[model samples]
Target: MPTILLIEDEAALGMIVKDSLEMRGFTVQYAEDGEEGLRLFRAALPDIVVADVMMPRLDGFSLAERIRAENQTVPIIFLTARSQTADVVRGFELGGNDYLKKPFSMDELIVRIKALLGRQPAAPEAPAGPLPIGRYRFDYPKQRLHLDSHAADLSNREAELLKRLYDQRNQVLERTVVLRELWGDDSFFNGRSLDVFITRLRRHVKDDPQVQIINIRGIGYKLVV
Candidate 1:
């Protein structure tokens, strides 16, 4: 079973989350703050880490940064309040894999966790410049897309989404398949997020009318080149 290290200061919420995750077959190590959480992280070396951003001693951003300094591939997810969009962005900037705003459902959290775990380990980097999309050049390692002389940087998740579609270019990729493979669940929220990402991607390639990520309503998406 995969081990998950959960760090949250709220006593009741902590227990509830831990119990919910355990019931879902994950081995969890609970901590009340970031200092102790970091210690446990070093000791247990869990497969994944779920932490709250407002903990005492070591905050979630710092904890995740520290963890990344030691291990780059171990997925880390942040839990924070809705207003802390800056913190959420910083958490991802610090190498966290995902984040859940406060007041989120346990089911949502579970599916996000499952989705991150389901990601295939990144493969060895390829030699040369960047992978070519219809009229754009996508540099996967750098998370950049170039159109003519202009370049747009994408978030890690966005880059991953683009890579998946590029790999299956000209194919109709099911919505659920993409959701399960990239977001862990095919829930409404994630589906909406997928829509946002799709829109962002569409804008990125809009300079070239030849490239399109078409939405096949009630079905999925098709990357047309």
Candidate 2:
């Protein structure tokens, strides 16, 4: 059985998630606030985490940032009621492995947790190479990207996206394919969410004129250099 740290302030929802996960053969430790959640998270270092965005003592984003600073590989799933684009983007920026908006079904949460844990094997160490995008260089082994003598910190999702695009350079990456590969599903909502990340990447590489993210009509995006 896998272990899960569930950080949720709502007593009813926390209990429901706890019971549901335990019934599925998982050992769950519940935390009602961010501080205790972080303490338990470090002590137990569970296989996965399910956290709510809003909490007393500390918000989900701060807790997640702290965890990511220490453990970059642990899986995290964020729970939030707000559907705003900024909220979603911030969650991903803070190293959330996945996101489930509020009012989500229990079944969906279970499926997401299973999918994340199942994909662990596929996320092998990134290949060793100097990934060149225009004048910028991405050293995958070192997890560093250099641009004009300056280094930029690429988040996990950013690194993943960059790797995929670089792997399929000069090729048309179907929107659905990228979504399923990166986000697990290609729902319209997720599509829009993906667009936000794409936008952020565009901003990150704005200095490189040769780096282009072309949007194909009703199709997908192509990263051309």
Candidate 3:
């Protein structure tokens, strides 16, 4: 069974989550604060780390940072009530593999955990030529977007999302479709994550005025070139 280190300050929620995961056949190492979480993490390395952003000792971001410094491969998921785009981006920057907003369903959490666990290390492959998008060239294999003289490296998720958008460029990439395909469900928390990614993609292509990822409000997005 894959071991999970769960760091949550709220006693009730912690127990509930711990019980739920244990019921699903996972070995859970539960901690009520970041300090305890870190101790547990060091003592018994876990397959994955699920931590809340706000905690008594060390916050989730700090925990992730420390973990990343020691082990770069373990997946870290942040649980936070804060929905600010900056907060979400910060979590990713701190090496968090995923973010789950508060009030999230147990089912959604389980799906995300399973998805992360299911990922296999990709093998090396030849780099494919760049695909043109307005004035930008997207090198999908390298996960890089280049303009005239600048290049921006994209996360794996970002590259996948951009490719999906490019595939449906000039047409609406239905919200539900993208959510289900990329996140395994159309849960509200996953939708929030998608919005953050969309915002990041827009920033990536912002240098090219001709490239636009228009939000279809309540529907999805359209990449107009």
Residue ranges of candidate 2 with Cα displaced over 4 Å = 118-163, 199-218
Q: Which segments of candidate 3 are over 4 A away from where they belong?
A: 1-49, 61-76, 80-97, 101-110, 114-127
Error of 3 at 204 (Å): 1.1
Q: Show the colliding residue pairs in model 3.
A: none
Q: Could you list the CA RMSD of all candidates, in the order they appear?
A: 7.0, 3.9, 5.7
In TM-score terms, which candidate is top? 2
What tens digits encode model 3's per-residue C-alpha lDDT throughout 26-128?
A: 9999999999999999998998899999999898999899987887657788998998878887787666768888999898788778766654223123246
Cα misplacement distance, residue 103 of candidate 1 (Å): 1.1
Candidate 1 is scored at a TM of 0.61
Please say which candidate is ahead in lDDT: 2 or 3.
3
Tens digit of per-residue lDDT, candidate 2, span 44-147: 98988899999999889999999888877577889999888778877876677688989988888887787666543445356767788899998765556789
Looking at model 3, report the run of 10 residues with the lowest lDDT sum: 118-127
lDDT: which is higher, 1 or 3? 3
TM-score of 2: 0.73
**lDDT tens digits, residue span 1-225, model 1:** 899999999989999999999998899999999999999999999988999989899999899888878866677888887445455445656777776888989888877776666534442334377888887999987778998989887755677788888877899889898777777668765576677678778888998888999988999888899
Each model's lDDT:
0.81, 0.81, 0.84
User: What TM-scores do the predictions have?
Assistant: 0.61, 0.73, 0.62
Best by lDDT: 3
